[model samples]
Target: MNRLKPFYEITVKLAELLDQDINAKNRETIISQVNLLIEKRGDLLPEVPPPFTEDEKRVGSDIVLLNNKIQQKMNALFIDLKREMKQFKKQKKSNKTYTNPYEKIQTMDGMFLDNKK
Candidate 1:
């Protein structure tokens, strides 16, 4: 009971962090914090604990929902990245074509004679 308070607090913090629109550096910080909390929780898991209270159960569900939101955000970012990459490739190809418009033309071999000989 007393020991679980810290764990619940950390879990709530993690959920709040995930819900925010944080930058990469802040996100890394949050990840490190979560990792530390996970390690600490892992060591404590062997001890038999009482059932979760209503509030604790609600916080757990909130964490799950936050994690899902984070996953969706990442998926959207990946999709946007792929779309931008495709646009970049198309632009590059168009630039190459513009710069080398005659690249497809085949050159004919011609003999050069020494007219001054």
Candidate 2:
């Protein structure tokens, strides 16, 4: 149960950051309520994270690595957007944009592949 705490907190943080609208009180609000609920009721957490098989380990590790990379890119994206926003001050359709969301997804994907060696 204790171990699940970190996982839930991490998920909450991810949700909070994804909200584009400043007035949006969706995931961020819900996750905070959940976190507070957890704090109030300690018994709801699972006793343990389910055991992982080798394949599961590999897949889970892959997900975790990707998540880390995602967080990294999101942070970078925010910084980049901040600079762009400061210059433009309006959302304009760019001629060049990330048509594919998975543009840099490979860089992180390959990390786990190489790490498994």
Candidate 3:
């Protein structure tokens, strides 16, 4: 097995996994697999220096493309996650306010007011 083969395979698998629809159930598995792939890729990183064969060059280019795709997808996912988090926070705040409308009202409970005429 060529050293680059495993690296390329990892990139391909990562791209495929990242392309899946993110939902309650798939989110956990997708995250775990992404982490696993990243670990494997880190360990199996290939160094092709100087003269490269045709196949090696092809695989290298493919890996580069796949990496770009993965990065874009990951970024999009993060943006979506951030948006979802904001919505969730908003919903919680709304719920809390609905439950207790005056929970956040400013009250001068311990303040002394003096009127000097």
Each prediction's whole-model lDDT (CA): 0.65, 0.51, 0.86
Positional deviation of residue 111's Cα in model 2 after best superposition, in angstroms: 71
Q: Kindly report which residue pairs in candidate 3 clash with one another.
A: none
Arranged by lDDT, best first: 3, 1, 2
Best by lDDT: 3
Give model 3's TM-score versus the native structure.
0.82
Candidate 1 lDDT, 1-117, residue by residue in tens: 454556555555655555566554565666676577667656766552658787767666765666576567556645755787799999999999899999886656675556595
TM-score, model 2 to reference: 0.32
**Candidate 3's residue-wise lDDT over 35-71, tens digit each?**
9999999887645444777888888899999999999
How well is each residue in 10-70 modelled by candidate 2, as lDDT tens digits? 5445544443443223535644654564454344334435775665565556546646754
Separate clash counts for every candidate: 0, 0, 0
For residue 108, give model 1's deviation from the true position in Å.
7.5
Those runs of model 3 whose alpha carbons end farther than 4 Å from true positions after fitting are 46-51, 109-117
- C-alpha RMSD (angstroms) for model 1: 9.1
The residue ranges of model 1 lying beyond 4 angstroms of the native Cα positions read 1-54, 105-117
Worst 10 residues of 2 by lDDT: 89-98
- Cα displacement (angstroms), candidate 2, residue 36, comes to 23
Q: After superposition, how far is residue 25 of candidate 1 from its true place, in Å?
A: 16
